[model samples]
Target: MNDRLLALKLFSRAGRVGNFSSAGRELGLSQPSASRLIAALEADVGAALFSRTTRAVTLTDAGATYLMRVEAILAALDEADHEARGTGELRGVVRVGTPISFALREIIPRLPAFMKQHPALKIELRVTDRYPDLVTEGIDVSIQFGALPDSSATARKLIRQPRILTASPDYLRERGTPAMPSDLAHHVVIISPAHPSPTFSFRKDGRVVSVRVDGQLAITINEGAIASAVVGLGIAASSESSARAELEAGELVRVLPDWDVGSMEVTAVFVSGKTIKPAARAFTDFLATELRN
Candidate 1:
């Protein structure tokens, strides 16, 4: 039997007031229950822990000796609990930088649940349509879509989403569908200004094709581009995960099913040479699991 925990609490409380009733009240246990726990502790140690009378109680010599060690042990346990809670409970500010579209559609919905898991934590989310230098921006974590190129910061792929070239059914019916990647030149393309230097590489039936396509309809934002494409304005390429609902709802159709339009490897990038904050690390892990599912 482990007498340490029961004895420790019993001894600490008893030592504090030198009375069983007061100790029992402080520890939220009945006097009889507390006394029995201390009595059992005395049996385990083979020593009389307390001198009791109808009127009052006092510590025995053994109890006095045990009291010092119990106090130190309890103090250490409390300090350890505080440190563990500081890490696990996530009670600090975590600055997160992310793309606007993703922040709006994906991460925000799950924010409440994550906050619930760490009630004491405060999250400051910065949503930008442009990439920011994580170190300069003082961001703990950055969620970015597309390939991270020539970045000095450390990053890990959180999710891999395949890009698919899609067009509205009305657009396809009126302008005619592309028979091949080369045929895209004959169709009107709606390009997202969000990606200024967009180029695509596709593989179809073991044959690779690269295209540097330009479009007539250029928009400054992704939501507007997606909206325009759905209204049959032109064709555009986007991550399949983002376009899944639209495609499933018959708002858009895949332009080329056999060819892969290239995959966007969304990554969690952090500042170089810095330990990721506990909150940021926890959030990143949660995102990775969510995207995988």
Candidate 2:
């Protein structure tokens, strides 16, 4: 790659990951070299692109804006290269953001087939439980679950995952199954305090009831909470898909099956300002089809 182009690539990656040394490793450069290259790029542009502190390296206001434009330029270059290749294949790297539990249960298992289909494409799968900033991370697309807040990003629904409440047979047998939604107040529940769902709503035959749950055990991760519930911890909130295999193996049983916990939607999210690269678009389409089936 051209020197300037390589620096720009490093800048973009570092800006999203919030680290230079890690980004340098990805691009096969040392920390000192990464710093020197970025410094040169800053001098060329006549502005400091990142604000460095002992604890963190963050983009300055101007740097953030410039990143948008530089990324656009790079994306366009990628598109031009693909068109010129004349092989009728999707070529280029696509960075994807996803929650870990979803990726493990749904996405990763299906990746082999997708990769075989687009052998020229490269994927960088970044996982986190929290919602990622699409623009900052340069994520081509993300798979998000639950309700989407009003935002600048555009989203397309892939599938509506029906959420469920589950408990191990041992736990249910010990505590006795709750007959009513309100009865949950008397039972020990598993919850993730980090997430904003302190309240859970259940609906049955046009009747809706919301319950505030408190638990002795708290697991911040969704997968951990589900796993905790498996060992007879307490009732847990889970998506049907995530709990599928466990449910089939008779380790978990649906609680209050007559009532519904509503749907947690699975969606493909894209930042509004950028063009969806052909490879990214194809990946999202493939994910949607697989999820629907």
Candidate 3:
């Protein structure tokens, strides 16, 4: 067999089944033959892919990493084959994952336009506060927020969202606004998406002052904390971009304007290097262009 195709089938099977014997069965080969093919492929690539045992077969970190790209190559090859065979249009399901706030505020509303443009395509949008593993969930694209720790998947910045500290107009009216970072101590800070330990920074006369703000309430990300703050519960912080509409609509007010608390990068990521689905690439490009404008 051509090594690339052999490797592709093997990798795909292994990834899909998460087991060697089942992968071999899918390929119509004995387990030993499948093992030999995988070994040969690994030798050619100079990587140890799966950690094997008598009882189970599991992807090594390297294997987990490589599986994404291998899938992409196979997808590209299939798409090319389909186009050559006179498939009239790009038609396939594209699975997209996004955070709850962004999904509600931006992506969902614009999704109809994309669907109209590519009528043949089926779109599955998953919106949740929890981050899902792209591969495990079979996600094609993900609109993610903040800087993620190191990972093999590729990420492209879609926009910059500044973190802003804000409070309800009612809260500000009663407790008084903090003119400086240090003054936050006197206010009831609403900490959401509770940090392991909370620390925040702001500016005072152009110098940065760091403060460890504590609160009576601790909630998880994109929950009712902001709502709580808006209802005069306390001061809260979140991505300014996320809170922009609310702030403009007078639901919340930006506090400590002089502070230079930097923003985080919001990115659109796809498991492309390993499994570059055309729909994923197309959607990612569309989002990047749309957000840029």
TM-score on alpha carbons, each prediction: 0.67, 0.85, 0.74
Query: What CA RMSD would candidate 1 show?
Result: 17.6
Give the whole-model CA lDDT for all candidates, comma-separated: 0.76, 0.85, 0.75
Which candidate comes out best when scored by lDDT?
2
List clashing residue pairs in candidate 3: 68-274, 68-275, 69-273, 69-274, 72-274, 72-275, 72-276
Please tell me which model should have the higher lDDT, number 1 or number 2: 2
Worst 10 residues of 2 by lDDT: 191-200
Error of 1 at 271 (Å): 0.7
lDDT of 3 by residue, 1-293 (tens): 57569767777768666776677775577888888888888898799898888777788888877877777677878679547757535576788998777777778778887888778888888887666777656677788776664476688778887777778898999999898888888887877642323678776566878887767777676546677878888887777756777798998998887787677677777764555677777788777787778
Ranking by TM-score: 2, 3, 1
Cα RMSD for candidates in order: 17.6, 3.0, 6.0
Model 2 spans with C-alpha error above 4 angstroms: 14-23, 39-66, 86-88, 135-138, 193-196
Q: Which ten residues in a row have the lowest lDDT in candidate 3?
A: 190-199
Better of 2 and 3 by TM-score: 2
Question: What would the per-residue lDDT of candidate 2 be over residues 96-196, giving only the tens digit for each residue?
Answer: 98887888899999999999987988999989878888765668898888766546678888998888888999999999998998888888788752234
Candidate 2 total steric clashes? 0
